[model samples]
Target: MHPIPRIGPTEAADRPRWSVIVPVHDCAPFLADALTGVLEQLAEDDCEVVVLDDDSTDDPARVVEQVGRDRVRFVVNPGRLGASATFNRGLELARGDLVHLLHGDDMVLPGFYSTMAAALDSTAALAAICRVEDVDIDSAPLYRTRSYRRGTGVWTDALDALAVSNRVRAPGIVVRRSGYELVGGFRTDLPHAADWDMWTRLAAHGRVAFVDEVLARYRRHPGSDTRARVLTGANVRERVAAIGVLAGYLEPRRRPWVTRRALVYATVFAARTSLSLARSGERRAAGVQLAEAARCLVQVPGGPPRISR
Candidate 1:
């Protein structure tokens, strides 16, 4: 990757503080609300919203115009670049010191930018994240996520936090542009866990600050990639692949521990996916998942018990 040109304080001051990149794909129904939420929090010329339409069949550009023609700059991709590539395009076009990539279906709360930006600024961390609440298709609150709420402070040991679980939500994360310049964009290869992978990489560079309050709403619907992938048993595979990739980034001595943890996590996750598939009336797929889980257990470094699923 080529080095990004260093910008002086004067040049940065001339640009927006926040470059909110909203990537939309067939999310016309939710675009208006998402844009509204972000537009309301924007501070005059200090923030710019870049709404990129990833060749959505539902004409997301119409929704963007209806919501805020003056507030947002809508760009329609000539061809579908998928999520990671589209987001990387936004990163290239971003002119702000801080970047926030918000999914079109997810809406930020009233004080999300203010709170998260403050956290990053005060802590001088590379990235800041707030607690995210899961919402139904209708945008009604389901439950608040406590993944990043271990405590409200700057976490310098981000690897430790992420090793347990992906505590940061994509919508809730606000990262410095310098971090992206250093770590590069999200991996197009890890579709399901690209965001998790990016966060882990950024964490390796600097601290990640967390806020205690819920600042964003993550819409959980059947159409979402995570839910759809999980239903098809692809989520398990992608998750394991992500764990393997992240394990490679660990220190030599720490790699062994992370590798074992990855296997254990993958095994447990496969079992859970199996149960979910069975509950969803996919008995055959569930059986396949169980077999995979058993295979994962058998593949552990040392031979253990011959556990049958």
Candidate 2:
């Protein structure tokens, strides 16, 4: 069982070790839980909470004022930046060695900060990720993401792990600021798959630590990108674009093989999802997903292998 951290306000240094940046836009309904989660796990001095308000119609700053108790730094975007750009804006404002882009609608589990911090410090990894519990809008657990590793340490096959899809949610992952400096901010074009693209780049270029424990809570609501994007098949198409980004990060010799495998996996997953959606009577959305699956399958460097369940 994870230990609950004692809540304490922080006046972290000008350059703290960790920055928990919460990007908020119309997420004030859940912002208090998000801020309280971070504030509770904040280290005595080396962690800072940065609430980036992306021209939110709701009062995210007020939420920070209450839950963060004026401890979290609140920054308002000059204009309305989309989710990807808003995250980049937060990245620009973060003043720390490690950056965790924790969305304002999501909350972390207890022991999240200390556990991930220790793993990154001990392993010298470019990033660290823990399993996440997927919860409903009411904060009840629906399911937990699968763990890639049993023990806490470097995940050697991290790139291949993310080759097809992104299992890493924002809350469950903390990346080195240096990694961000190297790869730059999230891709603006692939809004649905930008985080996946960024994660693949980080995993390709440097080692990533995996903590078997579930240290974050990811809220799965109807408004989330995954659900909203799937209706238009943007999820599958943007996934292909993200795979292209991943290929660009790899050596020429590894690109074709890795990308082919990724494409095949994507095609298979999309196909399966299409079938499931069709069975559930979402014919139009299913057709879109199926068309994307066919397009993805044809792009496989070599013809896709006969994949069976």
Leading candidate by TM-score = 2
lDDT of 1 by residue, 1-309 (tens): 222232222255578898999998888899888999988888768988999989999978778778886788999888998997788888877889899999999999998988888888788998988889989998888988775446668876677557535777679899898888877887877766778888888787788898888889998886666766655667766766777677656777887666666677678888988998899898987887787787777655555445599
Off by over 4 Å in 2: 1-13, 307-309
Q: lDDT for every model?
A: 0.79, 0.84
Give the backbone clash total of model 1. Answer: 0
Per-model TM against the reference = 0.89, 0.91
Which digits, one per residue and each the tens of the lDDT, describe model 2 over residues 1-309? 112112122234577888889998888999998888888888748787888888889898777777777688899988898898888777877778889999988998899988999999999999999999989999988999897988899988898778767889889999888888776778777777778878887898799999999998988787876887788988888788778877877778988988988898889888998999999999998998999999998899978676599
For all candidates, what are the clash counts?
A: 0, 0
- Clashing residue pairs for model 1: none
Alpha carbon lDDT of residue 170, candidate 1?
A: 77
Model 2, TM vs. native: 0.91
